[model samples]
Target: MDRIKEKMNSLRVEADESAAKVEDLQKQVKTLEQENLQKEHEITSLTHKNSQLESEVETLEAKVKDLKTAADDGTGHLTQNEALQRRLQLLEEEAEEADKNLRETNDKLRQTDVKAGHFERKVQALEQDRDQWESKYEEMSKKYSTVQKELEDFQAEIGNI
Candidate 1:
């Protein structure tokens, strides 16, 4: 009876150790899950911002093209009005302003694309980092399980002894 009691006590100790290891692993898994969620949200927000900037660039390019067409029309040869020259000068200025706006928009679009790509790379890096953590967790979990099995075997042997 004393031997049986000692065996039971040993089994209890082994069980407690296994429980603690499982709890630690669970905490680590929870932390990794939260980090993954945050990275996904940031990538989504940046993608939406890049899409809006692309639309704005397209609109600005269309407006610039319209201005260029108006300036190139042969109104100087067809009209005898002295104001035709002034109208041409104003149109030229408007076209120049439109050109400036188009270039600025294009630059902004390029920058947004670059930033989006950078964010994408960041996300990939994070995923790789997470993958490494996951592999480590798996390995540790396996080791913990093996230790638990060993404890059970030792407890069984103690009972036989």
Candidate 2:
């Protein structure tokens, strides 16, 4: 009887530990989900900025093409040609910088995606663990209740003696 009581006590302790672990896992899952949401938002913002940069580059390229055509025609003054060249150089530099930024953003997005995937998998695993622990806790609770009832009946019989 004492051994049975000790077993019940141990099971109760194990159940409490399992409950704590489940709670901790739930918190971790929530945190990961929030981080995933933030990363998604960042990706959306970066994509929008990339599109704007692409449009600007296209417009600048068109202007450069027009300037090239004007320079081809001997009618433009030398000073005008020099000014156009300077403007084209500046535009090209800006376009190059924009492209570099876009590439960096894309890389960051990819890394974020990977991290999100990893977190999702981890959450799934933790959820599975929590479920298993819950099942174990239920089983232990049932056993504990049964053992407690048996102990009560045994004590009652002893008291009658």
Q: Candidates' TM-scores?
A: 0.42, 0.48
**Clash pairs for candidate 1:** none
Model 2 misplacement above 4 A: 1-77
Q: Write the per-residue lDDT of candidate 2 for residues 97-123, one digit (tens) a residue.
A: 999999999999999999999999999
Ten-residue stretch with the least lDDT total in model 2 = 71-80
- Cα-based RMSD of candidate 1: 71.1
For model 1, state the Cα shift of residue 39 in Å: 99
**How would you encode candidate 1's per-residue C-alpha lDDT over 47-94 as one tens digit per residue?**
898888889888988988887766565455445455777888999999
Clashes of 2: 0
> Which whole-number lDDT from 0 to 100 does residue 129 have in model 1?
96
lDDT of 2 at 115: 100
